[model samples]
Target: MSENNTRVIVITSGKGGVGKTTTTANIGVALANMGEKVALIDADIGLRNLDLALGLENRIVYDIVDVVEGRAKLRQAMIKHKQSQNLALLPAAQTRDKSAVNPAQMRQLIEEIRAEGYTYIIIDCPAGIEQGFRNATAGATEAIVVTNPEMSSVRDADRIIGLLEAQDLRNPYLIVNRLRPKMVKSQDMLAVEDVQEVLGSNVKLLGIIPEDEVIITSTNKGEPASATEGSLAGQAYRNIARRLRGEEVPFLDLEERSGFFTRLKGLFGNKK
Candidate 1:
């Protein structure tokens, strides 16, 4: 198969439960909402949750495995979201393992999936450095590595960056998830800059996802946090989508700025 003019991206995390799938779903929805043809593929295989997070789990009749095996056509595996007209899902098969498919198979699948006019193809990869990860990044035009603001998570993200760099996935972007400005200011937790201090040199800072309860609540409700009104994290993801499209959106308010009162205090020799 031949490639199209579509941008295929892989959403990956070195560690588990670091919001890779959530990022995949939200960013996919945000892009589709912006009138782009998007398709979210569950490349996690057996342990797939991309469909559930997207609230289209029950709608899956075919999967990536099914497509590779030719049990059904590629179109038959895609489940369109009733809410987002341009957004469709290619779920993972629970009955299959990661070994069921390979990188070539994935490349072929995405090439065909893009034929349906999908402008953006986002693959939700499985955790760990295995064949699943290899297949997730087979022919990606770019990569978005997601990690939380923590030592363990950051460490894993660094390892992931190393692998991607070795693969030469140029211009891969990083998204610092669950950032808590208060904890960072108090020196209790890692800040967005801290994570960037480690991995940002290699990967561009795509966006910062703050630690918000709205994300959890929306996930349980089978809705993307970005869809909720005044959702900070949701808005952040939407901005990320726009940025991905080469749009220039202002930076979000992740940290509190120096107010007039704070500046006055500093000028009066009462800094802090």
Candidate 2:
């Protein structure tokens, strides 16, 4: 391996609809924005969506399956992101099933990519405990567990964390997504503190992404929200990027409507 080989990291969510793919896409861009060479692999197989999230769906001539099957070289399968010169994507084969590739093959492919001099290689794992998930996490040096602040999401995250530990993939971090502080205050949602208590383990908080309509619009438009500076979700992903780079960043206060003291402090500061 070269001195600048890639570091493989997996972004996984134990349950569906927890913004795993979205996180993967944005983090790839965020890392690249920091001048680190980053690559994203969509290990979702038949349900591939990372390409669409990165807006590289139409440019994929080869996929991960083709590279493993000797039909295409790894470079041929990698599609560079349009906006980020340092970011790239290795899409999943829409024509292939999860069984077409195995964990060992996935590891081999990642190793090859690592030798090619990328700094960060992120794999977007398929949802659920199946062969696809195994293939996705085959060679993860580190992992990011994405979960919403809810019981079902937390339960699924626990299952995934258990599986990772069983496989000796320790110290995976957590990113609390779509957190609504007002809802949590009203007893309608789970707060980050509550989530940490239930998981029964210490996980470094990355960033908190709020439920934003702009995120949905960006996804529908096939553009990552991280591309926009005005987006709260985009800011959250950027903070995660900084955290990934070992920088200390403060978490965002998601709840609106400040306390009387806080409001008074803001008012006084404005007057000064």
Candidate 3:
């Protein structure tokens, strides 16, 4: 396949526990559901968890390091999803550290996978700006900065955006995960606009995933929220997949569901 035919995207965050891995899993599954062949690479190395998130940990016989070090073929290390045949995972080697593979090797591995004809290659970058981050972004043609609706997360996301720009990955998209609408309405949390403002005008808002307990449950069950119905976070992820496919999808209305009078009072103010 031609290089233009495939999109290599790295999902990253400068801070940890911002739902970056979960976003990677759901986006991969969502794109696969849309009939696009997707390859997910867990680039965290020793601290790998994308396998567990995808529920394919037990099936991972070989990993990326195995492929990189010539111990296994690319296809041999790839673990195909049982439910979504279009989606496959190249898990990082838990026994190895980030030093096990370098940036050039990562680029080569991504190209090898690209030749396999996958439309989308999603790289789940390890948290922080370290060797792991460098390896993950080295092969990426695009980037998505995942963050939470908080001051620290936004600050870290801004730093990451700068790093991506420095690496020539311009116009990176943003996914504000774990946003609590009630908190936003109550002025306790930063709104999506606030995050965008902090990240600057260059970073575009890709999607907003409302805080949902279903995401935690789904991750624990080894099923991505995007694959399940009736999940707001899942719907948000699916929308992001659609957007990635060049479809214009409106952002989900994250306003808390409330009684008619309450909603009316929210829209209009309380009468003096």
lDDT of 3 by residue, 208-237 (tens): 998888888998999998996666788889
- Model 2 Cα shift for residue 83 (angstroms): 0.8
Q: How accurate locally, in lDDT, is each candidate? A: 0.85, 0.85, 0.90
The model with the greatest lDDT is 3
**How many Å off is the CA of 246 in candidate 2?**
0.6
lDDT of 1 by residue, 134-192 (tens): 98888687999999989888899888888887767866899989888778889999878
- Poorly placed runs, candidate 3 (over 4 Å): 1-3, 256-272
Q: What CA RMSD would you report for each candidate?
A: 6.3, 4.1, 5.5
Off by over 4 Å in 1: 1-3, 256-272
Model 2 RMSD in Å is 4.1
Pairs that collide, model 2: none
Candidate 2 per-residue C-alpha lDDT over 1-272 given as tens digits, one digit per residue, 9 for 90 to 100: 36345678888889999999999988888889888888899999998999988888889999999999999999988998888989989999997888988989988888888877889999999999889888889988888899999889999999998888776778788999988767888988888888888987756567788877777888888788876665667777888998898888877555642355654443354320
Best by TM-score: 3
Which has the better TM-score: candidate 1, or candidate 3? 3
* TM-score for each predicted model, relative to the true structure: 0.91, 0.92, 0.93
lDDT of 3: 0.90
Candidate 1, after superposition: displacement of residue 250 in Å?
A: 2.3
